[model samples]
Target: MISQEQNEFLTQVGPGTPLGLLLRRYWFPVAAASDLNNTYTKKVRLLGEDLVLYRDKSGHLGLVQERCPHRGVSMVHGIPEQDGLRCQYHGWCFNSSGQCTEQPNEPEHSTFKDRIKIAAYKVQEMGGLIFGYMGPEPAPLLPRFDGFVVDNAIRVIGQAVLPVNWLQIMENSMDPVHTEWLHGHYHEYITTQNGSKQEVAFQRKHLKIEFDRFQYGIVKRRLLHGQTEDSDDWKVGHPVVFPYMLAVGSGGLGTYAFQMRVPIDDHHTWHVWYNAYVPGPDVEIPDNLKEVCVYEVPYKDQNGAFITDYIDGQDIMCWITQGAVADRTNEKLGTTDKGIILFRQMLKEQIAKVAKGEEPINVFRDPAANQFIELPLERKKHHFSEGFASITQRFQTKYCPVAQDLIALFERVGVH
Candidate 1:
């Protein structure tokens, strides 16, 4: 359990805070790659720092302090230059390294150019997203996913702006029981079968949870809440990477979703993600497959919304209702919250490590890692319909055979 002090520390994500320091240890997705095209400057907020994202004409991306050094004007009005971004207010140019290069208005003032520079962070592009590291210079190389670096697979990226704390959104990824209840039992927008509500339950024993640590090369066993005779106790183990990343799988769709919770502030977060799947060559990809969903959950509403609405709407309703701090003191967590407990414990441990200047888990870059897969077999029995069978058959026949060898290869390398 986190102490009151620790909880307070976790809530503050401003620069130098414990949670901010911990989160800065890993690279975070700040904007979509598509959004960075030929733009002079884009305003973004991450870890509570308001900053400007711009790409120089030389084709380099930068994350710099939002305010210009000269007049403290916001850099959002800057124009792209040959080698940097030039502030529209006075034509002060800054390079990708955040160094003020040209002060056209201050000719002969070499000292101004030499001494004036806005704060900047390391930025990189990977897997169709742009990532920024806001902590320190010489930051570690952005972590790579071996599974995603494949040659033949198509990639898709999407994002959502959720109205909740970053921790609440990140922790939600660790709770698997929500799938059974929120996605299954609840009469939400997504669960209605053509306007009809269906009561759904999970067969728990068959649910398997594994936490794959890329650095340690260990897949730990996770105890999940099993289905019982009297009540439905839903719990599943979820791997919580140190910092702010959570890797989770849905038991029904065999979909693995990676969520990066970027804090806009203490009360709002940018939920950026990449939802990818290995589609067979024979299958045509849908134009709208990479759709983005936004959810706005208020801070005072408890029985607010269901998970079935556009994913963003559902999350917003559920999380905002918990209020800004998510008063866990008044809440009761049981067996179904196992994943949540594990997540909180892991976070506390990582915070302690950060406090001591030690490296937390799963923050290193490893090129030899295996790909992760979310097995959908646990809920396969529940989906029994001609249409469902047809879809399954199409997926199996078109992709499974060709990918079996690739899947086996990943399995050999310890991906599950």
Candidate 2:
């Protein structure tokens, strides 16, 4: 456990905070591209700063402070003009660059517009998501991760605003052992898609966990029984993209899902789960799968209790039960928590780097170095047999929809 002071230093994200400043250096999705229209503006809160995101009539994107500079009016009720948003309270207007352009309440000849401005930042759209950079000047280019750049892929954005600290969700991603219980023996099987379900016990079996640092982030490897040292499971694992995002499945639909755990503040997180489905080389893409859908998911069931339907729901339960900014000061961690330990260490190191004014691991400067970044997925593709036991593999497969799709993808891709 860490001291209260140390905990605050790592998790608090108000302006000028250590962790918040570190996070600001990288670009994160502020909203779904398809959700933003000329009709309305989206309110975004990140790193404890409230901001507004909108698309103008001209189809340009704008991200600026949520409150107007003049009288601190909320832009949520503002009007989207041809180039910027105008305050509905008065005729005062601000451009997409957050520069005050018009002050109608003032004298017709007044020059007050030149003396005031609102905070604005660089915003860009890629892979069906709108991303914003809130760091220092000359912002780095948003790296085009391979999962977001698949050709002819059907992009899916899974958005959820969890009432918990972003750190809890992030730490959970690094922990591969949780699958043994939360998604394994402790979980009740629901249904199956493939042929006759195979039943096998997975309790008390010896498993090995490994962590390897990648160019972008960490790759977590879980080795189950019957897997050898040179096996793919023991080799490559899923990529935990720096900051917060996980690439899951995509072998079949020709897409992979990117799990984005974006911090809305110290206690709230904008959990945007991105899924991309790409059809095979010669296979015809289905018309139904072509439609784009972006929506928020709830964590409750019809019964009103915390939804325990599938693995994802179960995972959410873990996060919520931990409380917002979990009392890491009172928790007991075991050997299975090595990944979390490594994650915390890296967090500290990266925070220190940002403190020294040096860029962290995944922050890219050169545009050339920022595109088409792909990690080793050969393990996730070929090591499918190692993720669970045969007896409960179907339920495991059903729980991890991404991996299920990719398992078929691996077979088609002809990856040994």
Best by TM-score: 2
Flag regions of model 2 displaced more than 4 Å: 189-206, 250-253, 379-416
- Candidate 2 matches the true fold with a TM-score of 0.88
Residue range 152-215, candidate 2, lDDT tens digits: 6655565778889988898998887777666665553522233333232333243888898888
lDDT of 2: 0.74
TM-score of 1: 0.74
Worst 10 residues of 1 by lDDT: 376-385
Q: What is the lDDT of residue 305 in candidate 2?
A: 81
The per-candidate count of clashes, in order, stands at 5, 8
Q: Distance (Å) between predicted and true CA of 211, model 1?
A: 7.0
Q: What is the TM-score of each candidate against the true structure?
A: 0.74, 0.88
Q: Assess the local accuracy of residue 399 in candidate 1 as a C-alpha lDDT between 0 and 100.
A: 25
Clashing pairs in 2: 158-273, 199-391, 200-391, 250-255, 251-406, 251-409, 253-278, 254-278
